[model samples]
Target: MLKLDHIVKDFGNHHGLRDVSVEFPANQTTVIVGPSGSGKTTLLRTIDFLEIPDSGRYQFDDLDYDLSKPLTKQEVLAARRKLGIVFQSYNLFPHLNVLANITEGPVQVLGKNKQEAEAEAHDLLKKVGLDDKADVYPDQLSGGQQQRIAIARMVAMAPEYMLFDEPTSALDPELEVEVLKVILELAKMKNSIVIVTHNMDFARGVADKIVFVEDGQIAYQGDPTTFFNEPNDRIKAFLAAGQFNVK
Candidate 1:
């Protein structure tokens, strides 16, 4: 299981996270939702070490780390091999084609052969509905297509845990669906997945557990059914403003 205890992130003027503690069980999809600047993204980033907390204890199965200190290069790389993250901006290599972008991590980081990596990349491309785009670069694809390719690239590494930080926030509503579809599919297949998104409809459909963050703290954490169907006043207000669908 993945767990955090009393995690705190200070940004001088404001706190990104304040005495936060949560657990993300294996084989469960956990979705984090909150209003803007409520530390939802910060919580996700901390899990993947994109942003180190000022004070906290992070534990993943056998490994444990004190978040008060910066991690060594080797420590970060070792941890990252088990964790994969996709940001809002699809950070593909402009110089490399889709196939190269997807194969790079497995070949370089995981020590897989070029041929094997390429073979898996092709299969992943097909999974994302973008097999034909393997020869194209990031600049050539649309926003949705690029995001889909980004997902494929991350999945190619086959991390034990997957993290997405507002992945569809940058796309148009139509384009957002394309990315969300791939993510939903991943949530179904992957063992551990955490997503931070504002789309209540997608969150309700995809998450096994829902975590509501408010003012740098977790306001609620429970099964998605109760989270959406039996919301408290604060959650009800959030749902009313958060593009929620009652049906």
Candidate 2:
């Protein structure tokens, strides 16, 4: 459902990504794994349009995204609505409670009435196993709970695709499992999901395909089981070194 061609991004002296190209199928989970500084997060941001590419072609459905063209107000809004992003850090509002945080996008962006938004938020919270914490503030919730709330918040927006940037990176081991459960459940759904993570287990368990990035380029892309079980010498060496701490 999404295609990127020759995507390249550079930050002056730093190379974020180079000649990266890949396709993400609809209703399937695709995991991008790499060591730090390998451009995993940058690729996600570029796909979500948060980071403009220096040279590339990004096609979503029939629309071609031009990195150089300034986004119109409507175009920007529409493009953003097509995908939801969850950061490594829980980006919840300090002031908003779980319910409010989840409903804010629907109420404001989609222009749904507060009552309608709340109903949708309630259902989404329940889906993420956060229904009981709807009234709780983010600070009051554990990291896992907060992350689930973040997931609910994004799901409430009903985006066409979801981009998760190491959703479990900041959590404790216990909390990581809690967040992973929600993600695993999401992976079962009929929505496209692209995750940037070093968690090898999670990728093997949930990903339909895996893409390994190294030195700002796609080093490997194939069936997760095949890649994980019979990785090439370079990948095997990298995995052996535990360079990215894949666990």
**Local distance difference test, per candidate?**
0.91, 0.86
Q: Candidate 2, residues 98-174: lDDT per residue as tens digits? A: 89898889988889999999998888888887789888899999988888888888988888999999999999889
User: Each model's TM-score, in the order given?
Assistant: 0.96, 0.94
Worst 10 residues of 1 by lDDT: 238-247
Which parts of model 2 have CA positions greater than 4 angstroms off?
A: 68-75, 243-247
Which stretches of model 1 miss by more than 4 angstroms? 245-247
> Could you say which candidate leads in lDDT?
1
Q: After superposition, how far is residue 217 of candidate 2 from its true place, in Å?
A: 0.6
